[model samples]
Target: MLDVLRVTFPFFALVLCGYLAARWRLLPLEAIGGLNAFVLYFALPAMLYEFGAGTPLGQMLDPVAFTVYLACALLMVAGTVRFSLNERIRWNDAAFGALVAAFPNTGFMGVPLLVALLGATAAGPAILTILIDLVITSSLCIALSRLDGADEHGASAAARKALRGMALNPMPWSIALGALSSGLGVRPIQPVMATISLLAAAASPVALFTIGSVLARSQIVAAAAEHGPMPARDFVPVAVAKLLVHPLLVLAAGQAAIALGLPLDRFTLSVMVLVAALPSASNVSLLAERFEADNGRIARIILLTTAAAFLTFSAAVALVGPRG
Candidate 1:
């Protein structure tokens, strides 16, 4: 237990530090955007690129693991969307809800934390999951949102927008380039590799702090209060789907893959489960707000899941242990 805490405590502590800094005005809220940009646009991509560039191409493109993970995520998204529709939730709001239920915070928190917990090799699966969510899950949600009359554009336009957004995202491109380098057996020059290492090193602490700062700025309690009591009927299910159901599905899928003799290994399976167990990405709420969905509800879901994740993640790590 102490061993587990030793590993998990620093991650949460950095988050707490950020939360306190924001609460005490030690780090002004406005600074968060710049910090986030640094992580998203620079640090994270470099970290992933290095991982991909250095890892064997086969490991980087573990098709069995990627397929299983994607299947589980799609199932969760479909189930959530269906349930929301049955409950008479607006389609656009339901789409965003589905996103909250399915999209894990793989980039900001998952990548760095898993790298720490499972080592650099975990980066392959982590990056794969991120690409899956960004490219597939997000596109599905955007299409649904459009169907719900949220957009003036049609489905084709929604897809084009999604594709364009993904193309513009540096993470996927970095992963691709890194994989290309690995495949071609080309390594970055020493100076460039050193620079990449420096940026990658900053990813974990800065990203964790940024998460806490964002949480502090969210003022979840105030949002809940102003919105009145959250409709338990609506909120509880989404939170459960994200924090509990999502991980279970991933675990089930991985187990099934192994039983069927897929090349999935225990450590990669554990990494997939842990990543699935992460709270909904903070950006889900932002997406909701942008699309004029139920942003308050999404915000509360992010808060609840994130708060609960410490225990859930710690328990998961203890049960799964780390990759040998």
Candidate 2:
């Protein structure tokens, strides 16, 4: 346990520091916005490219693991919708409720933490999971929310928009390029690799701190004012699905994969499981606000789940390297 603490403490400390900085307004909120841009547009894409490019395409793109991830995401979304309907949730409320239950903070938090804890190699699975989360889970959330809005044109328009967005997204493109490089056996010179390393190194902390800044600005009280009642009682179930049930299901699926004689490294699988366990994304809160869909409830959920992830992450690490 003490050993686990040593590995986990530093990462949590960084988040704590960011939260404190935000709470104190030590940095302007706009600083976070700039940092977020640098991370998203530059550092993160470079990191993804280098990591994705460097990985053996065969291992990183395993069909079975990918299938398991997709299945888990689909099941969670379906379960959330069913539960929401049974509880008499309205359309927007149910949409946001399902959103909370489905999406993970795979980009802002997952990339950095995976690189730190599991190394560049582990990043392959994290990146894969991020793709799954973003492309599939995110699109589903948008569709459900639009349906609730009674927007007939939304489904088709949103599909086209999502396809275009994904096609143009730098990180995903970088991943595609990287896989191509790996497949073609194109290794860069040492000096070029060094530059990629430098960019990748800057990705995690900047992203994490920027996320903290965003979290700081979330006005839970104000969001509540606009989005009907606060729905405090309804929150627990969403939190459970996000912070508990989802991860456990992923873990079980991973274990089954392992039992099937899959050639997966335990460390890689652990990275996937941990990334899968992350809370409802901060972006979900932003989207909820944009669509006028219960931002306060979303904020509360993001805050609670992110805080809970610290302990959950430690447990995940212990599961992976209990003796380390």
The total number of steric clashes, by the backbone 3 Å criterion, in model 1 comes to 0
Candidate 1 residue lDDT tens string, 228-321:
6657877778888898899889998888888988889888889889898888897676667666777777777777788788888787777775
| Winning candidate number (TM-score) | 1
All models: lDDT? 0.82, 0.73
Question: Per-residue alpha-carbon lDDT of model 2 for 41-148, expressed as tens digits?
Answer: 888888887877878897568777688788888888888877876444655666777777777887767766666666667767877887887678767766676665
Overall local distance difference test of candidate 1? 0.82
Residue 283 C-alpha lDDT in model 1: 69
Can you give the TM-score per candidate against the true fold? 0.92, 0.87
Q: Which sections of candidate 2 miss by over 4 Å?
A: 86-89, 187-194, 220-229, 257-268, 321-324
Q: Residue 212 in candidate 2 has what lDDT? A: 64
Error of 1 at 226 (Å): 4.6
